[model samples]
Structures are given as structure tokens and as C-alpha cells.
Target chain A: MPQVTLTVNGKSHTVEVEGRTLLVELLREKLGLTGTHVGCDTSQCGACTVHLNGTSVKSCTTLALQADGGVVTTIEGLAAADGTLHPMQEAFREHHALQCGFCTPGMVMSAVDLVNSNPQGLSESDIRHGLEGNLCRCTGYHNIVKAVAAAWPVMHGKETVAAE
Target chain B: MYDFAYEKPTALAAAVASLAGDMDAKALAGGQTFIPVLKQRLNKPTTVVDLAALGLVGITVTADSVTIGAMTTHGEVALSAAVQKAIPALANLASMIGDWQVRHRGTIGGSLANNDPSACYPSAVLALGATIVTDRRSIAADDYFQGMFTTALEQGEIITKVIFPIPQKAAYQKFRNPASRYAMVGVFVAKTAAGVRVAVTGAAQGGVFRHAAFEAALSANFSPDAIAGIATSADDLNSDIHASAEYRAHLIGVMAKRAVAGT
Candidate 1:
């Protein structure tokens, strides 16, 4: 086993893993951070999404060893140290953005990344098109769009209305 | 995934040497397609060479062409100001590939190396008359692609970059598969100083290919009306659940018209 050092959330973790170990497997099996769910083994489903070096990437497709020098942020790290829900999480709850919630963690993580990077504004069509990579069987996408729009201000410190 | 030794080479020489040392070694690029297949045990290799550390990551624009490094992510290429200015069609094609996550991780080299029949990158190469640069040699687009999941790359050869000439005008149109987002039918058309080239993906049984008849028609008359009577036979086209060969043939014409009309 190759020893690998990676900064997850805010702490550093050193673990021995097979060189071929995937980042998703390391997060779920080794670190016990099961919030990032694996929907499709292929990179098709954005369910295994996480922020690697500040950009959203599907964890299953990213090898653990490749992230050796990179900092990774999972859903577990989204909350405040005092256990306060992130604004996106709060918005999702308020808007009923999830059904089974299997894809919520990844969805919220990706949404936060999207809104943070986009400062101009995101319309309903932009949110839907931006989150097209994520699939949700239960939510008909009405609330997911609402959650993203509602959380945009909290995440970006800006207020905007979604044009109906 | 099958157990295999993995090597992340920091240099191109190291990557090639690692592959040359192991007969059953495969270069791992984006891992968008290859990784899933590896996990499914469809491909079992003794060693895997990871190219992330090689520093082959940039988009360079020259006087008449653009050079994209092998390890350049689709997102980088799509959002690159240089690429957008020089060849907006390429940027548009990159943006439409798979989805955000896929674009974030998927590299052009990996997509070309894997050579999935439904992939989008190959059509760009064929249409723009790009050159596939390897550590060993440079290959023109016409000689690079062989068939499905095949390329002209020899063992241990690493693709360094792909050089695409700036086109007069070009556009790519794709009908996406709703589930996987693979192209149900993708067409790339480019008008260059040499001539007009038309390449189609997802609709072909072998892989991405140019349409000589359509190219000839466009070369004669650079208008949609020129290809009004041209017919794409279904002899070697793909026929699957997404689209029948006949339907794909019709799409070829429709997409060609749209591409020419800049719609």
C-alpha cells in the first residue's frame, strides 16, 4: 500500500491505500465520510460530487493518489464548526429540495460551487442547465431550482429574483 | 477495478518509459470512459500510468492555429478566452460535452485515446484538420483514428498536444442521449482555406468520419442548397436505440444545414 497524504475538509489525513484506490472509495470507506454518494460508477452521475482544489469533480472518477497534494472538501465540511447548516443546506430544507436525499449532498455541494463562481446572477434556466449533470429521481426539479435560487444570496451575499 | 500497479509520471519521458517497461501498461488521462471500463473488468492491465503530473496542461494560440495540451481539461478548453476568440466553435463543442463534472475532469487526450464512437472530440479533429502530437511523432487527423476504441498511437507513445488550424467558419451540432448525454448524432462542419470538411460522430458504426459527398458538394457551393440532393447512404452508418441509420442519415443533412447556416 502506498502512503498518501491529503487535506480533507480542514484537517490533514494520511492513509495507506492501494495505488488504484479512487477518491470516492477513500472518502467513504476509509474516512467514513459517506455523505458523498456514488450514483453511477461512471462519471455520468454527479452524485459522487465534491470540491477538489475548489472545483466540483465526481469523486468516483478521481483517483485517490491523484489528489495527493490537493485539498478536498466534502459535504461533511460544509457546516460551521458549531454545527450550523450552510446556507445552501438551509435553503434546500426550506424549499424541500430533496425527496430521498440520496443526491442532495452532492447536489448542494455542486450548487454552492456554482453560485460562488457565478457572481453576475443565475436565472432559473441557468440553474437547471448548470445542474443538468446531477440527476434526481424523486424531486421533479421544481424545488431544486428554487433551493439554488434561494441559496444564491446566502452563498454569494447578493440578492436576485428568478424571473418566472 | 482490477488490481494494478499505478505510476504517476511527472515528465513525458518518465511516462513513456513507464509504459515501455510494462507490456500491459495503459496511460490514464481523464478516466471518464477508461476508468469505468476498468472497474467493470472490461480492461485489465498490469500497470496504469497517470499523466496528471506531467504538466501537459495549457491552451496556446498561435498566428494561424491553436495548440491544446493533452492533459487540458474540457472545462479549461471550453472557458479559455484564447480558444473562444480564435475558434468559438471548439469552445462551444467543449461546453456541450457530457456535463459540468465530466467537463471538469475529462481531458481531450483521454477522450481521443479512448475513441468512443459516440464521443465529441474526434469530430472536431476530423473537421478542423487537427494534428495529434505524440512524444514520438505527429499524426494528422486523417491518419490518427482507425476505428472504434482505436488510434494510430503506438505502444508507449504519449500524446503531447493537438494542433488545430484556425478555420474560416465552423460549427458543431449534437443531439444528445438524454440518459448518458452521449451524442445521439453529432455533426461538425468546418470551412477552411483548403476546403470544407464535414465530420459526423455517434451516427457512424466505425467511428468519427468525414463525408466526402457532402464535402464535395459544399466545396462546389458553400450553401445548404448545394447539399439538397446529396444523400447519405446507410450502408456503414450506426443503427441503435437512440437513432436508426436512416434517421441519422437525415440528421446528417439537417445538422449540416444548420452548421452551414450558423443556426
Candidate 2:
């Protein structure tokens, strides 16, 4: 067993893991941060996406030891400590981006990264293409796309939301 | 997945030693493709050598070539300004790989070493006349790719970096499989310093291959109309539920035409 130390959100924890243990398993099983869902187990579903050193990576496919000494931010860490929802989460709630809600956590996590990385702003097609890894089995992408567009302005700290 | 001893060596020599010591030891890079295969129990290695600690990640642009370290992720390459300026087509090819999450972790060397039949990198490498540098020796793109999921890599061999010469005119056009987003037919057209080369992936049964006929046509004329008369035979093309060999053969022409036209 290898002892791996990683910072989740703002907390640091060292955990022992087998070589085969995945990063998702460590986050869910050991740290009790089950907010990150493992929808597809395979890399297809973005449900396991989390910020690794500020970039989104599929945790289900990442080995536990691979994340050693890395910074991770899951859905649980996305909100402010004051209990205010992150802009993207608030956008999802405001625009009803999710239903059946199975994919919300990953969706929100992925969405935040997507918006933040593109400081220049994103178009509707860019959002659609950006979120291609995230599948809403409910097929409710119209509202999701709308919600992402709404969130973009807010995420980039612009006062007025995009008119789209 | 089998329980294997994991080693993350800080130095390249130590990493190579860890892999060379055990024949079953596999080098883990990015883990986009390797982990999925491992989860399916398709591969079992005695020890997994992680290449992350070796710091094999970076990109450099010289006068006429771009050098990318083995561990440089697709996301990094796609987002790199230097790579975009040096070879916009390469950046375009990288951006279209897998997706955002996969791109953040999938490395150029990992894709080359795995050499999946439908991968987009091999086509760019083949067409651009890139050089694949390994721990031991450098292999030309022409000789690096062997076939589907096969390459010229020897046991315990590890790729360090890949150097791509900037082409005067180059573009890649891919017809994607909707479900998997893997290239159903990808054609990279490049007018390099040497000559014109056209590399096609996904459709070929023998994996990524250069189309000599299309290359000759484009070299003489450098236009889509030049290859309009050339016909790609369905023979030796991959046939599956996703695409019939005939359909893929047709796509080869369409994609190559688009690639040449810079669409």
C-alpha cells in the first residue's frame, strides 16, 4: 500500500491506497467526498470530472497514486464556505440546467472549469462542444445549454448576463 | 484490474530501470486509454511505472520545428499559443481528440505508443514527417507506426519527445464516429520541406497509412481538384458496424479533399 497525500478543496489528507485504487475510489471511499459521481466508470461520462491542479480530469480513470501531492477540487469544494452556491451552481438552479439530477455534480464541476478557463467568453456552440463529455441521459441539453450561457457572464464577473 | 506494484520515479533513468527490470512493467502516461483498458481487465502488468515524476512535459518551438515532451497533454498542446502559431493544424487536430477531460490527461507520446488504429496523432505525425525520440534512439514517423495498436517500440523502450517540422501548408480533416468521437476517417495533408504527404487513419486495416496516390496528385498540383480523380480502393480498409469499408473508403477521398482545401 502506498500512502498518498493530496489536497482536496482546501483540506489536506494522506490516505493509504492500493496501486489499482482509482482517484474516484479514494475520494468517495476514503475521504467520504461522494459528491463526485462515477456515472460511466469509463472516461466517457464526465460525471467523475474534478479539478486536478486547476484542470478538469476524469477521476474514475486517474489512479489514486497519480494524484499524490496534487490539488483536487470536487463538487463539494465548489461552493463558498459561507454556504453560497458557486456561480455555476447558482446558474444551474436559476435556469434549471438539470433534471433527474444524476449528472448535476459532474456537470456543474465541469461547467465551472469550462467557464473559468475561457476568460474571453464562450459562445453557445463552444458550450455545446465543451460539454460534449457530459451526457444528460435525460437529453435535456437545451436548457443546459441555456444555463451555461447564462452562467458565463456571471462566471467571468460580468454584471449583466448574456442576452442569449 | 490486477494488483500491481506502482513506481513513480523522479528520474528518467530510474523510470527506465523500473520498467526494464520487469518485463511486465508498463509505463503509465496520462492514463486516458491505459486506465480504461485496465479497468476492463484487458491488460495485467506486474508493476506500473508512472512517468509523471520524471518531469517529461513541455513544448518548444525552434526556427522550423516544434518539439513536444512525451508527457505533454493534448489539452496543453491544443491550448499552447506557440504550437498554434507553429502549426495551427496540429493544434486543431489535438483539440478534436477525445474531449476536454480526456484532452487534459491524454499525452502525445501515449497516443503514439498505443497507436490505436483510429487515433488522429499518427496521421499528423506521418504527414508532417515528425521524429519520435525514445530513450534509446529516434525513429522517424514513417517507421514508428506498425499497425493497429502496434508500434516499433521495443520492450522497456520509452518515448521521450516528438519533434515535428513545420509544414508550409497543412490541414487535417476527420469524419468522426458520433458515438465515440474517434476518427472514422482522418486525413492529414501536409506540404512539408521534403514533399507532399497524405496520411489517413481509422479506415485502414493496417492502421495509419500514407496515401501515395493522393500524395503524388497533391504534390504536383496542391489542390483538392488534383485528388478528385484519384480513387481509394475499399480493399484493406477496416469494416465494422460503425462504418463499412466502402463508406470509409469514400470518406478517405472526402476528408483528403477537405484537408487539401484547408477546410
Candidate 3:
């Protein structure tokens, strides 16, 4: 077992892991951040998406050792310490972006990074193209696309909440 | 996913030395494909060398060519203003690769090294006549790719960067497999100072290869109509469940025409 130190969601934790341990396993199993779901272990589904050093990457494909000493932000980290949901999460909820809620966490996480990358704005096609990594089997991506589009303004600080 | 020792070397020399010292060591760059292969137990290595700390990530554009580091991710290359300015076709090709997460983690070097039969980068490299630089030597694009899932890379020969010559006109058109986003048939057409080059990927059974007939026709006319009559033989193409060999062969011409037209 190798000891790896990671600053996940603002806190630093040092833990021991095997060489084959994946970053998603470390986050969900060791750190107990189950919000990052592992829908597909092969990295196709973005259910295991997370932010590593401010960029979105498939956590299932990332080894724990590879992320050593790096900053990791999962779905749990998106909310304020006071419990206010991140604008993206709020927008997802307001837009009913999820069905069964299994893919919401990863969808929200990936959406936030997508919006952050494009500060200007993202069109409907841009949002659809950006969300290609994430698969929502239930929503058919209709409302999910709406959620990402709705979150854009709020995420950019142009609006407080998604329009009703 | 087997138990393997992990080494993260801070220097290129150290990384090379680590790989050379162990015959069973494999260098990991981005790990978009390597990790999946590992997880499936397809490859078992004694040591996995992480190349992230070597600072092998950057893009440089000169008047004649664009040089990209080995570890530069597809997303970075696609979004780079320099790459877009120098070769918009290459940038567009990068942008069209596997979805956002994969693009964020997949590197051009990794894609070229793996030489997946359906990969998109090899077509660009082959069409652009790029130079693949490694720790040991610089290989011309003509001699770099050998076959499917194969390349000219010798053991412990780590790719350092790739230099692509700027073309007067170049474009890549791909018909992607909806599920995997891998190219069912992809064509890259470039009209360079030397001549015109048309490379096809995914459709070839042996791997990416240039279509000399299409190249010749386009060289003479420099238009899609010139190569419209050129056809690829289905006998030598790949046939899988997603696409028949004949269909892939037809797509090769369609995509080549689209590439030449820049549509």
C-alpha cells in the first residue's frame, strides 16, 4: 500500500491505497464522498465526473496515485459550507434536470466546469455538445440541456436563479 | 488493474531511465486509453510510469509548422488560440474527438502511440506529414505508423512531441460511431506545398493509410469534384458490426469529398 495525500474539497487527507486503486474508488470508498457515482467503470458514463485541479475529468479512469497532491472537488464540495447549493445544482433542481437522480451529481459537476470554461455564454448546442460525456438515460437530455442553459446565467453571476 | 509499482518521475531523463531500467515498465500519459486497458486486465506491467511531472505539455506555432508537446491534452490543443490560428482544421479535428471528458484527458501522443484503428489523430498526422519526436529519434510521419494498434515506437522510446507542417488547405471529416464516438470512417485531406495528401482512418484494415489516387486527383484539380470518381476498394477495408466494409469504403469517398470541399 502506498500513502497518498490529496486536498479534496478543501481538506487534506492522507491515506493508503493500492497501486490499482482508482481515484473514484478513493473518493467514494475511502473519503466516503458517495455523491460521485460510478455508473460505468470504463469511463464512458460521466457519472464519476469530478474536478481535479479545476478541470473536469473522468474519475473512474484516474488512478488515486495519479491525483496525489492534487486538488479534487466532487459533488459534495459544490455547495457552500452554509449549505446553499451551487448555482449549477440549484439550476438543475429548478429545471428538473434529473430523473431518479443517479446522474444529477455528475451532470451538475460537469456542467459547472463547462460553464466555468466558457465565461461568456454557452448556446443550447454548445451545452448539448459539452454534455456529451455525461449520459442521462432517463431524461433524454431534454431537461438536462435546459438545466445547463438555465445555469449559465446564474453561474456567470448575471442572474441569481433559473428563470421560472 | 493488476498490482503494479507506480513511479512519477519529475524529469524526462529520469522517466526515460526508469522505463529503460525496467523491461516491464510502461509509460502512462493522460491514461485515457491506458487506464481502460489496464482496468480490463488487457495489459499487465510491473511498473507504470507517470509522465505528468515532466512538464511535457505545451504548444508552439512557427511560421511553417505547429509543434505540440506529447502530454498536451486534446481539449487544450482544440481550445488553443495558436493551434486554431495556425491550423484550424487540426483544431477542429481535435474538438471532434471523443466527448468532453475524454478530450480533457486524452493526449495526442497517447492517441498516436496507441494507434487505435478508429482513432482520428493518425489520419491528421499522416495527412499533414508530421514529424514524431521521441527520446531516441525523430521519425517522419510516413514511417511512424506501422499498423493497427501499432507504431514505430521501440521499447522505452518515449514520444516527446510532434511537429505538423502548416498546409495551404486542410480539413478532416469523420463519420463517428454514435456510442463510442470513434470514427467509423474518417478522412483528412491536406493540400500542402509538396502536393495533396488524403489519409483515411477507421476504414482501413491495416490502419491509417493515404489514398494516392485521391491525392493525385486533388493535386491536379484541388477540388472535391476532381476526386469524386476515386473509389476505395472494400476488399481491404475493415468490416465490423457498426459498419460493413462496403459501407465504410463508400464513407471513405464521401468523407474525402467533404474534407476536400472543407464542408
Candidate 4:
């Protein structure tokens, strides 16, 4: 067993894991953060997306050892400490972005990272292109694109908050 | 994935030493492909050497060429302003690989080392006549790739960097598989001081190779119309469910023409 230390959601934890344990497994099984879904064990689906060192990566393919001494942020860590929703989450909720809610966490996480990367602003086509990695079979991605487009203004501080 | 001893060497020499000592050791770069292969149990190495800690990342641009480290991710290469200024076509090619998440994790070295037949990097490497720098020596791109899923790298030889000579004009056009996004037929055309080179990937059974007739036609006229009559034979090409060998051969001409016209 290897002892791996990582900071998740502004908290540090040292845990023991097998050499083959993936980062998603550690988050879901070890830390009890199950919001990160495993839609596809392969890297095709972006259901296991998480921010590793401030960049979004597929957690299902990342080894636990690879995240040692790194900062990780999952979907559970997105909201404020007082439970206020993130702008992206608020937009998703208001726009009815999810159907069964299976891929919302990964979708929101990847969207936040995408918004962070693009500080200027995101257009409708940009939102659609950025959502290519994430697959949502239920909603047909119409509301999802709308939600991401709505969050861009709030994320860039151009707007106060997402409208209800 | 089988349990194996993991080693993360901070220094390049130590990583190479650890790999040379164990016959069944595998060097892990970005792990974009290696991790999926391991999860499928396709490979079972006794030891997995993680090369993330090694300081083998960065891009250097000189007057005549650009040298990129092995650990540089596709995202980094695609976003690098220097790479974009020096070789916008290479940056465009890198940006079209996989997707946002895959680009963030996939490294150029791992992609080149794996040498997937449908990969986009090999065509650029072959057409540009780049040089692959290893710990021991430098190997030309012509000699680096041997076949599909094969390279000329010796046992335990580590690729440190890849040096690509700047061309007067170059462009790449790829027809992607909708599911996996791998190239079904990709063409890279470049006009350098030496001559015009045309390399094709994803359609060949023997891996990426230069198209001699296309090259000759382009060298003489440097236009899409020059090679409009030239058609590659389908006898030696790969035929899969996604595309037939004859279809791929047809796409080669189409893509090559598009590349020339774009450039």
C-alpha cells in the first residue's frame, strides 16, 4: 500500500491506497464523495471530470498516486460554505439543464473550469464546443447549453447573479 | 489493472536507470492511453515508472526550429503562443486532438511513443522531418517510426524532446472518427527548403508514410491541381469498419488537396 496525500476542497487528507487505485475510486470510495460519477470507466465519457491543480482532467483515468501532493476539487466542493449554489449550478437548476441528473456534476465541474479558462466571455457556440467532452443522453444538451451560456456573465462578474 | 510497484523519479537519469534495470518496467507519461490499456488488462508490467515529476516540459523556439519537451501536454502545445507564432499549423493540429479533457492529459511524447496508427502527431513528425531526441542520441523522424504500434527506440531509451524544423508553408487536414475522434484519414503537407513532403496517417497498414507521388507533384507545382490526378493504391492500406481501404485512399487525395489549398 502507498500513502498518498492530497488536498481536496481546501482540506488535506492522507490515505492508503493500492497502486492501481484511480483518483475517482479514492474520491468515491475512500473519501465518501460519490458525486463524481463513473459513467464510463474508459476515458471517452467525461463523467469523472475533476479539477486537478486547477485544471480539469478525467479522474477515472488518473491514478491515485498521480494526484499526490496536488489540489483536487470535485463537484461537492463547488458551492459556497454556507450552501449557496455556484453560478453554474444555479443556472443549471433554473434552466432545467438536467433530466435524470446523472451527468450534472461532471458537466458543471467541466463548465466551471471552461469559464475560468476563458475570462473574456463565452458565446453559445463556445459553450457547445466546450461541452463536447461531456455526454448527456437524456436532455439532448439544449438546456445544458443554455445554462452554460447563462452562467458566463455571472462567472465573469459582468452580472450580479443568475436569474431565476 | 494489475498491482505494480510505482516509482516517481524526479530526475531524468534516475527514471532511465530504473527502467533499464527492470525488463518488465513501463514508463508512464501522461497516462492518457497507458491508463486505459492498463484498466483493460492489456498490459501487465511489474513496475510502472511515473515520469510526471521529471523536469522534461517546455517549448523552445529558435531561429530555424522549435524543440518541445516530451512531457509537454497537448493542451500546452495548443495554447503556447510561441508554438502558435512559429508553427500555427502544428498548434492547430494539436488543438484538434481528442477533446478538451484528453488534450489536458495527453502528452506529445506518449502519443508519439504509442504511435497509434490513427494518431495525428506522426503525420506532422514525418512531414516536417523532425528529430526525436533520446537520452543517448537523436533519431530522425524517418527512422523513428517503424510500423503501427512500433518505433525504432531501443530498450529503456527515453525520449527527451522532439525538434521540428520550421517549414516555409505547412497545413494539416484530418477527417475524424465521430466516436473516438481519431483520424480516419489525415494528411500533412509542408514545403520546406529541402523540398515538398506529404505524409499520410490513419489509412496505412504500415503506419505513417510519405506519399512519394504526391510529394513529387507538389514539389514541382505546389498546388492541389498538380496532384489531383494522383491516387494512392489501396492494396497496402488499412480497411476497417469505419472506412474501407479504397475509401481511405480516396480521402488521402481529398485531404491532401485541402491541405495544399489551405496552406
Listed per model, the TM-scores of chain A against the true chain A are 0.94, 0.95, 0.96, 0.97
lDDT of 3 by residue, A10-39 (tens): 999998998889999999999999999999
The sequence of per-residue lDDT tens digits that candidate 1 reaches over residues B37-97 is 8888999999889999999899999989999999999999998999999999999999888
- In candidate 4, stretches whose alpha carbon ends up further than 4 angstroms from where it belongs are none
DockQ of each: 0.72, 0.83, 0.83, 0.81
lDDT tens digits by residue: candidate 2, B102-154: 99999999999999999999999999999999999999999989988989999
Clashing pairs in 3: B1-B38
Q: Fnat of each prediction?
A: 0.69, 0.78, 0.78, 0.73
- Worst 10-residue lDDT window, candidate 3 chain A: A155-164
**What tens-digit string does per-residue lDDT give for candidate 4 at A1-164?**
89899999999999999889999999999999999999988898899999999988999989999999999999999999999999999999989999999888899989999999989888888888787889888999999999988888898888876244
- Model 2, range A1-164, lDDT digits (tens) per residue? 78999999999999999999999999999999999999988788788889999988889999999999999999999889999888788878878888888888888888888999999989999999999888888846988888888888887778654345
Instruction: Please give me the DockQ of candidate 4 compared with the native complex.
Output: 0.81
Which ranges in model 3 have alpha carbons more than 4 Å from their true place?
A162-164
RMSD (CA, angstroms), candidate 1? 2.2
Of 2 and 4, the candidate ahead on lDDT is: 4
Q: Pick the DockQ winner.
A: 3
- Backbone clash total for model 3 is 1
Model 2 ranges off by over 4 Å: A160-164
- How many clashing pairs does model 1 include? 0
Quick one: how many clashes does candidate 2 have?
Answer: 0
